[model samples]
Target chain A: MRIVAALLRRDLAQMFGSGQRGATLLPVLFFIAVAMLYPFAVGPNPELLARTGGGVIWVAALLAAILPLDRLLARDIERGYFDQLYLRGIAEEVVVAVRLLAHWLSFGPPLMLATLPAAALLGLDSETLRTVELGLLAGTPGLAAIGLIIAALTIGMRGGAALAGLLLIPLAVPLLVFGAGALATGGSGGIALTAAISLLLVAITPFAGGAAIRAAREG
Target chain B: MEPARITATDLACRRGDRLLFRGLSFDLNGGEALQIVGPNGTGKSSLLRILAGLLQPFAGKVERNGEVALLDERLPLDSDLPLGQAFAFWNRIDGAGYRAEELRPLGLERLADVPVRYLSTGQRKRAAVLQSNARRAGVWLLDEPLNGLDVEAAAQFQARVGGYIADGGIAVIASHQPFDVQGLTKLHLGDYAP
Candidate 1:
């Protein structure tokens, strides 16, 4: 437990540390940027904006999560942090799990907060805003999970970050379907299912990421 | 820490289609220092990884009874952080602190405020050595541990490994250059090449 605490502390510090400040905010700004641009791209039709704005917000959140993958596993793996942790009796899964939490903490809450202005930007009503926020709360974890899995898998490959973003879209489609679909359905069932998928992804990511780390060591 | 033992039986390593080494075995006990000497691309590093349990052997098994620490080509320190902060990061995880005297021997105290990326090759190597020492693991797997050390730091590193082994820790070094340490066993990896 002490080891995990130390791991969590290290992971959190690394995720939000000084040098990564720009990268950390890149995702948030990217979310808002996407929100801001949607209006310009489709022209100023308030009805069309409000109708599709919730789904647009969901899309922005997913893309923002991908922004951090460039440094995620590759930096640590390249720096030999995972090897040292493994030697210290800290399993790769623990590192991946803690990283998942840190990634969510750094990316999720802020993106959720950004949605406030994003909702207003797209002129979403209070009810639609609430649904978007709740759906994001349930969906972003799944996004973070898939992001991490792809990050681990793509480690050491040339042009991996770009490839990971492409890889993530297909995998994240389900989360998008369930979470963003909730906004359209106006039902709690969609939110519940999104959370379920989020839970499943979270559970599987540790094992999958752990194996990827070990395999990456060999490659 | 409890006494440590690292043993491998008929261990084989293959990188891609080509086999690196095979039919190798050894027993490393506490207070033992084994130096693996070989030409480049001969899998000296791979053997160390196999022993460290970082890589799976192509056709063998290894039994380990204690914690391991590795100091390879990579420093493992956060490059953007100052030297002190980088070491502090590992110290937090290792649950041990680097004493002032320990830093002096490695000549790291004076460079504490320098970002690791700014340090020269030799300085980064020394900081990596210092951090691995901080791990205080029972077994040490060092790949080319003396790669970039200057004359002074090289001698100091030799002395430190001396102390590490004297304290019942096991040290395995993989380097083409001779390591200056007492009672060192030279394991030439070329003998085991397939």
Candidate 2:
């Protein structure tokens, strides 16, 4: 348990620390940037913005999630941190789980807070803002999981970072459909489904990412 | 320390379509050391990885009786943090306390405050050696353990490894360079090349 705690500390530090401030902050900045630009791109009209803002936030969050995927697992594998952990009898699943939690903590809640300004930028009222928050709360864990899996799968390839970003969009459709769909319906059903999908993705990340890490060793 | 043993039987390794080596086997008991010597790409590192159980052999098996510590080309230290903090992180995970005295032999006692990325190649290698020694595992699988060490640092490494062997530790060192340690035998990886 202590070992995992140490790993979590390292992961969190790497994500939120000084060295990776750009990677850590890029998602939030990009999320807000998207919200800020939507009014200009589509021509600002309050009703339309209110109706469309939630989906835009969802899309922004999804794209923002992609920003950190490249750094999530590549550096550790390159530097042999995984090999050292394995030598110490730590399973890849355990390390992946820690990374998932850390990755979520780094981006999820920060994006939620950034949504406040983003909602205002999009002229979304309190009700829509609440739904967006709830949807993101439930959906970003799944996004983080998908990011981890993709990062591990692409660890050794040439131009892997670019490839990982391309890979994440298709895998994340389920989260986007359910999360943003909640805004259109103004109900709990879509949010519930989003949470359910998030739970499933989170549950499978460690195993899938672990398998990917093991396979990458063969390279 | 408990008695430790590693035995590789009829081992064959394949990297991509190339067969690196085949029909290679060795056994090392506690207090024993083996140097895997070969030119580049003869499977010296591959054989060490197979013995460490990090890589599966294409043919045959490895039976290990103790936890293995591998010191490969990669340093595994965080480049951003001070060397001491990076080592402390691993020390905490390994459930071992930090002892400054251990860094003296590697001449790392004064460089602990320097960031890992700022350290020179020799300094980085010394820090890696220190980290591996701190693990205190019964079995040590070292790949190119002396790659960038100065003469004094290299001698210190050999002395420390010799001390570890004297205390019933098993070490499998893969290096083309000469390594002086007690009860050490040489395995020519070229002989096993397919």
Candidate 3:
């Protein structure tokens, strides 16, 4: 429990300490505002707005997730923190899990918060708004987990952004599917599937990210 | 009782398709210090990581006594943390703890609240060494422990390291700089090839 706290604190400190919080927050706000405005530019048609809201939210979240991957392991790799992590006798899985959780706390919550205003702007029904929030809570962890893996894989690459996005978007397909599906259906079954997928992502992310980090450190 | 330590037998390593070293064998006993000296690009850091169990040798085995602490050259500090907070982070990992007030007099306390990224190279190196010592392990593998230290800091480092040895701890330091490291056996890695 202490270790987990320590990890969480470290992640939060990194995000705020380095002023990365502002960078992350700005994009989310911009994305939400821009997405909301799309309906205004076209028309205030409820059917069109409702049909597009889920995909826009998911896409915005995906873009936000990608924005931070370049910063994740890159700095640590350059400063030799990754090697320090390995030598500290902490299991790689624990380290990866802690980092992923921190990413979610920093990047995931603000995304959900921003989604609320966008949902309202798009004139989403209460049911649709609830679905959007629930789907986000359920699916963001998987996005973070996969983002972390790609970050580790491309720690030292020259053109990391293009590569990380290419590698991660494919893996995030299931997350996008389940998340958008839940928001679109506005039913308990959709919520259940989203929850299961989120749980699976939370469970499996550590192993995948841990293995990648270990391998990268070894080289 | 003293814990059994590792014996490296015919250890070999390669970096980027080139062999760094090969046919190397040695034993690290408790309370012993070995200095690995070599020219640039000779893989001294690589050798230290292998000993610390972070890197596996291409063709050798390293049997560890128990837990090992490695002070990597890159001093992995949390740039977002105040210096003190970064030091405190060591506690999260097993075998990493320290007497907070005792370290205050070392001038580290003044900079405790400063983020690690703002520290000078020598200061960062000092913190890295101190943090590694905090781990309280039987064996410490330090890669270029004295790289950026000034004369006074070097003396302080030697004293601390000597005290660690007196307490039955072991250290292996890799450096190109000379220091008065008494009773430290030299392992000239330049003589070996990958």
Candidate 4:
């Protein structure tokens, strides 16, 4: 239990603490930038902005998740952190799971907070903003899980970071569809589906990512 | 601590459809050390990885009775963190208390305040040795442990290995450089090449 706590603390410090302030802040800034730009791209008509704004937020959140993927597992693997951890009788799955939680903790809540300013910029009503918030809450964990899996799978390849970004887009479609669909459908059903996908992805990430890392060691 | 040993029988290694070595076998016991020496591309590093359980042997099997520690080309410390803080992170996970004396042999006691990125190659290698030592695991698998050390540091490292073996630890080193240790068995890996 202490080992897990230590791993989580170290991971959190690496991702969101003073050492990586840029990493923690970049996604939130990018999220707001996207919200700020959508109005200009589609023209400043409030009705259209409100109607499409929730989906735009979902897209921006997904892209923001990708920005950190390159830094996730690559540096650890290259520096032999995984091997050292494995030597201590700690399984790879345990490390991957800890990393998943830390990754979500770093980006998910901040992106959620940034949504307030984003909502105002797009002129979204309180009801629509609520749906967007709920959708992101349900969907971001799944996005983090997918990012971890892709990062582990691409650990040793050249141009792996760019490839990981491309790979994440296809796998994340389910979460994006259900999350953004909540606004247009005006129901809790899409949010529930998004949460369900998030649960599945979160459960699968540890085992799949663990296997990918072990395979990478052989290469 | 329980007695620890590593036994390998007729191990074979294949890399990219090419067989690097075959018909290799050795047994290492506590209070003992073995140095593997060979030219480049002769599977010295591969043998260490195999013994470390990070690589699969093409044939045969390896059996071990204790936790393994490896010192390789990569430094596991966080580059952005000061050496002390980075070591503290591992110390928490490893349940180890930092000993200032461990840093003395490598002349690293004063560099703990420096970030890992600022350390020179030999300094980084010394830090890696200290990191592995912190684990106090029974089996130590070191690849090229003497690559970048000065003569004095190299002597210090050799002395440390000797002390570790005296304390009932197992050390298996892979290096092309000559290593001097009392009662240390030297294995020429090229002899096992297919």
TM-scores computed on chain B for all candidates = 0.96, 0.96, 0.90, 0.96
lDDT assessment of candidate 4: 0.92
**lDDT tens per residue, model 1, A14-49:** 878896767788899999999999999999899999
**What is the Å distance of residue A53 in model 1 from its true position?**
1.1
- What would the per-residue lDDT of candidate 3 be over residues B1-194, giving only the tens digit for each residue? 25637689998989879998898888877777788888988889888888887777899888878667787667667776787777776666543554566565355767877888899988888777777657677887777777788888888888888877777777788888774565798888878974
- Per-residue lDDT of model 4, residues B1-194, tens digit only: 46889999999999889899999999989999999989999898888889989999999899999889999999999999999999988889888746687677678889989999999999999999988768788888989999888898899899988888888999999988888877799999899988
Q: What share of the true interface contacts does each candidate keep?
A: 0.76, 0.87, 0.68, 0.87
lDDT of 1 by residue, B1-194 (tens): 68999998999999999899899999989999999988999999888888888888999999988888889998888888888877777777877757667688888889888999999999989888877758678899999888889888888888999998999999999988879777899988899987
Q: Per-residue lDDT for A1-219 in model 4, tens only?
A: 998999999999998777775878999999999999999999999889989999899999999999999999899998999999999888999999999999999989999999999999999999999999999999999999999999999999999999999999999999999999999998999999999999999999999999999999788
Better of 1 and 4 by lDDT: 4
The DockQ score of candidate 4 comes to: 0.87
**Model 3 steric clash pairs:** B21-B194, B22-B193, B22-B194, B84-B112
Best by lDDT: 4
Q: i-RMS values of the candidates, in order?
A: 1.3, 0.8, 2.2, 0.8
